[model samples]
Target: MAKPGVRPLTGWLFVAPCALVFAVFTLWPMLFNGWLAFQDYFIAERVAAWNDFANFVTLYKSATFRLSITNSLLMLLTVPIIQAGALGLALLVHRKLPGIAFFRATFYLPVVITVSIAAIVWRYVFHYDGMLNWLLTAIGVFEPGHGPQWLDQHVPALIAVMLFAFWKNVGYYMVLYLVGLAAIPRELTEAAVLDGAGPRARFIHITLPMLAPVIVLCTLLSTIAALKTFQEVLTLTGGSGETVTALYFVYNMAFSGFNFGAAGAAALLFTLVCLAVALVQVRVMGRHNPFRRPA
Candidate 1:
């Protein structure tokens, strides 16, 4: 016979399989990576030895790692501009105006395209004989044969990457803003209008405040995406340019150098920095989140 209080245990029986899979795949790998960070694993002959804090010391002292961190932080600065572009598009299409649906669909088309594919498409555009250079030359913005080399330098490559990132992600963020805008009760805007509020005033005092939670969420997501940039850099610059981001460093160490131990250490440290940023997002925005109950 089944025990009297067996129902709770039965539910656990159903959950047990998923829990086991998670432990095996997620938890085990994390623990293993943590251990690897402390080991002195050499690619030569696949030798391994115990070494505590050696990776950390080398990583912290390396100038390349420092430069990578700087580049990552610099890239992160573009998130707000991306949000602004997204917000503008969302506002334009959130209403039931004529052709609004078409505009919304057009803006969102880029989001559905794969990043690698889009980057490849853009790579041609950024080429020396690309359309951008040709257009600039025609417009007298540059000499016919001496246009700027976008992928040849650090600043230009990072700028190209930022522009691509903004173009790629803005539409996705716009859809999120549209959802938040839809959830906003119409009555609030109507009341503000009846009270003689101007368009700018209503937006400043009402719409912006109402979109706070969504904006914060987008900021967090975009910040994470920006800081962990890799594939875009790989496809856009062929990983040969002067731009080497933190994730690119981790990738290079693991694959090119075959220093998995140092890579794991760098990955762990990068995760903690990202964790701190996420914690700040929650701490600062959790109370203002519309989903939260009033205290």
Candidate 2:
């Protein structure tokens, strides 16, 4: 009964359920959120009404919103450093050293742990007068009470949050790099070696060139993660939110301040900013992405 050189409509039927679910959960929320972004929300009115661009104008005047944007951008700056570190770790572990699998597993195990659980563990480690400061004191870096304030002070607070983000995600990115490194043909590296290319030259020309896609993927992932930071800020900074991120700002605007209209606009702006960054990343990396063949 099926047409020649064509399958039945069974393929569409098979995927219908997943498509419906995606529509209900993902598509609906996004459409509704986009609609709400232009509206004023009021408990008195018990509904939303379009207020045009008033919310956006008010948001631009908010100092806290400005600060949050600065903080988010600061976290975004860490993506390159973390990605480089992950690449180095992956390259080191990609070797056929004895028990390398064990080492890989150990490094990746932390990434599987729940974020809340990891945050709790880091809380104690980063607490004032905690284990880290104790070690610092013992090493004669500072007196017992003079260690860096990982949570309290403004500058160090941002640094502490960035450090936690790096620690949690570096292993995840490293695993991706490991896969890329493994896929590289041994012949290429060997050929470079025979051409009198030293270790640095070989990596610069052969290994790194091939891993461009992985690097771009990890950088974009980390940048988005940094932009949307929330749990780490809450747990590490005790929700005082000294280094408030854009997501946290939206949350506080909606829940704490009860400024639903401004919050919606902030959320929309944040999304647009993230989208712009992602587009920029794609454009920059698309030039040399090895996954694409010349047309």
RMSD values for the candidates in order, in angstroms, are 3.3, 2.8
Writing each residue's lDDT as its tens digit, candidate 2 over 12-87 gives 8989999999999988977777777788888677898889989889988988898888888888878988898899
Give the worst 10-residue stretch by lDDT in candidate 2: 283-292
TM-score of each predicted structure versus truth: 0.88, 0.88
lDDT of each: 0.87, 0.84
Poorest 10 consecutive residues by lDDT, candidate 1:
283-292
**Can you tell me which runs of candidate 2 are displaced by over 4 Å?**
1-19, 43-45, 289-294
Best by TM-score: 2
Task: For residues 1-295, write the lDDT of model 1, one tens digit per residue.
Answer: 5679777779789999999999999999889889889887877777778789999898999887877777888888789999999999999898898988899999999999998899989988888899889998999999889987888888888888898888889999999999999988999999999999999999899899999988988998899899988878888996656678889998998898888889889888888887887676667776775446798
Measured by TM-score, how close is model 2 to the native structure?
Answer: 0.88
